[model samples]
Target: MKYRKFGKLDWQASALGFGAMRLQIIDGNHGNVDEIAVIKMMRYAIDHGVNYIDSAHGYHRGNSEIVIGKALQDGYRSKVKVATKLPCHVVNSTADFDRCLEEQMERLQTKQIDFYLLHHLNRLVWPKMVKLGIFKWADKAIADGRIAHFGFSFHDHYDLFKEIVDSYDNWTVAQIQYNFMDEEFQAGTRGLQYAYEKDLAVVIMEPLRGGRLTVPPENVAKIWEEAKIQRTPQEWGLRWVWNHPEVSVVLSGMSKMEQVVENVAFAAHSQPHNLTAEDLALIARVRDTYRAMGPIDCTGCRYCMPCPNGVEIPRIFGWYNEAVIHNSPQRLRSYYSDPNMLDKSERVENCIKCEICVEKCPQNLPIPELLDKAHAFLTAKG
Candidate 1:
């Protein structure tokens, strides 16, 4: 496996980090993890030199970490470095942070977390972290040897990302959702470069846009075929991010053994700036095809934010767009039903036709009308 420097740390991380979000499952059921299959996939990845395994407290409703703990048994624990996130959204105080971290450590069956992150940071949670002195807690954890390094995974605008990165000099890394289709959304290339300039390792999530780029539409597939160089959809997607020197690792949540093998092979051979001009042009075409079919034009600029009714406009639009773009209505419905979706205490039905977001929208999108559509669709499905 190819190794890259993880920020300023002496240790080198594998280019291909195994994202445990999509570990082998039984009949596509998120709750029913195929333990034996997952173990096999993990062992295969380890044998092939994948040393970084990432999981989270909220993934698959906390079952992901348990399955990973089971897979790391029988001397497999020492073969890799485990990275997991603390659910910062659940933190009401410093005590809650302690409780969550302890539970995560127990769930993973590991004494020390090689890389610990504050999970899913946004505008709403950042202020609370500052108010509760979260950095102080992280500093203490690092000094106590409970967490080897401190960082966060982000899901907000570029401005907020920079603020968070600059908030602490000790932040070793930052994880963000990035892919060819989302180069301008949620920190994109700008945030990655900013973090890199500050010497923070940038780990990438959703390298395939939550599997959208991997399963391209017919038009997208045709564009890939015309690229002249032979590559699978997965290889193309991963190679796009690997082409960037700023990206430290591309995490793929592989659910099948074949996927694991293919990703490892691609990572082993990928190099920065390896793609030619023609290759890039082809990718641009594919992106255009997907964008044409996407539901919402929301750039996630967050201009229409701070809703008076406390609605998470960008996130709601995100879920709605995913449903339309991927044609996975059921998946979108599941996201709406998630307990965490109600955290702000505002649902699609709570819009009340305030029209506050529409005026602020840079895209001039019909915010109220869209919310009405989303509410009807999700409620009907529920």
Candidate 2:
């Protein structure tokens, strides 16, 4: 495995980080992880030189850390740097920080977290975290040796990302969702470069856009085939992210043994600026093809945000676009309907035809009309 410089730290992190969010599960149950399989897959990746294992308090309904803890046993724990997140959403008080960290350490069966993150920092949670004294608690944790490094995973705009980075000078890492399709999405390319410039290790999540890029549409597939040096969609997506010298690691949540093997093989030869001009042109065509498949022209710029009726216009459009573009309507429909994925209050059903979003939209999209279509399609019964 290739190792890269981790921000300003002396340590080198593996190019491919093993994300434990999507470990094998039994009977399609999120909480019922196939422990034996997960352990084996994680161990395989570790054995193959993937030295970073990333997990979270809420991944796989909290069973991910347990399985990772099991996998790190038998002397494997010494071979890797374990990274996990504190569940920021559930912390209601200053004391809750220590409570959550203690619980997470217990679950991981580790006394020290090599890299600890404030999980899923967003608009609503950022202020609350500051008000509750997250930085003070983090300093205490680091000084005590419980946390080796401090970082955060983001899901907000680039401006907010910049503010957060500027707010903390001791930040060691910044994790963001990035891919060819999401260059303008949450914490996109601009944020990636900004964090790197600030000497923060940029760890990438959703490098394959949650596997949506792996299974390309017919037009997208054709674009890949057009390349003289052919590669899988997975390879293209991962290599695209790894091509950036600023990225320290690209995390993939492998659920199968083959995926572990394939990703490890890919990481072996991965390098920044590896792709040629032709390769890049082909990938751009593929990206354009996928974007063209979406019915909504929304760019996720958040210009039409703060809907008067609490409607998440961009998020709703994103779900609808993903459904149509990936040809996964049934799966996305279920996801759209899940209250955990998108709160019922924020769903498109709350749109009151205020035309406020329409006026704010740079795309000039018929905001209410599109919301009605999105509501009908997303809520449709199988």
Candidate 3:
């Protein structure tokens, strides 16, 4: 296992950190985790040099921490730095913060969380957390020996990400969703570099875009086939993120023993700037091919943002395109309709055709027309 500098910390972190979000489950139930299988896979990763185990309060419906706690037993707890998140979305008051942290620690069977992140900090959640005195609570936790370090995971625009980083001076890490396809999405390359420049370790999540990049379409598969040095889509996605020297660790939520073994092998060869010009070109070509497969040419640049009508233009286009390109309209439509994922006000039906986004769009796309089509497709009943 290759170890890299973890921000300003003297300790080195493994290149591949095990994310406990997608533990193997039984009968397709997200909450019914296969404990024995999960324990084996986790211990295998730890034995193979994955010293960072990342979990959250709600991952696998709260069973993730429980299973990880079990896996870390038998003297295995000393071998790793356990990281978990305080679910900011669930915290309604200052007391909720302490309540949640205590519950999470109990679940993990750990006294001190090595790295405790504010989970899913966005434009809305960050301010609320501040108002709830999260920083003060974190300081108290650190001083009391419950938290070793502080950080946050983000899911918002780059501006908000910078604000969060600048708000705190003792931030040890900043986790973000980064992959080959999401360079312009939430907390993309710019956020990654900004946090690194500020001396905060950048931990990458969704390096494979939630496993979407692993199963390539026919067009993308052909592009990969043309490469002289062939690699799996998973490896390609992971290596692309690891290629950046600013990244401190890349997290993969492995659900199978095979995945753990394969990822460990890939991490062994993970090095900064390891890919050649040709390799990068090939990956870019693959990305372009995938984009071309979609109907909308939205690059997720967020140029046409903050629509006057409160419509999320680029986000709607992204979901519509992914539904069509990946041939998962049912699943994507479910996501589009989920109130938790997107409010009704942000849907395409909210677009008043004000022509404001039209002017801001760089692709010169017929914004209203595309929204109509997307709405019809995304809301269509199968």
Q: Give each model's whole-structure lDDT.
A: 0.85, 0.89, 0.90
lDDT of 2 by residue, 84-171 (tens): 9988878888688888888889999999999999998876678889998888888989999999999999987788899999998779
TM-score ranking, best first: 3, 2, 1
List CA RMSD, all candidates: 2.7, 2.2, 1.5
Worst 10 residues of 2 by lDDT: 335-344
Stretches of model 1 off by over 4 angstroms after superposition: 27-29, 302-315, 334-367
After best superposition, candidate 2 residue 153: deviation in angstroms? 1.1
The predicted structure with the larger TM-score, 2 or 3, is: 3
Segments of candidate 3 deviating more than 4 angstroms = none
Stretches of candidate 2 off by over 4 Å are 306-310, 329-356
Error of 2 at 33 (Å): 2.6
lDDT of 2 at 346: 83
Which pairs of residues clash in candidate 3, taking residues 3 or more apart in a chain or in different chains? none
Q: How many backbone clashes does candidate 2 have?
A: 0
Residues 350-374 of candidate 1 have per-residue lDDT tens digits of 6777888999998999998987777
Better of 1 and 2 by lDDT: 2
Q: By TM-score, how accurate is candidate 1? A: 0.89
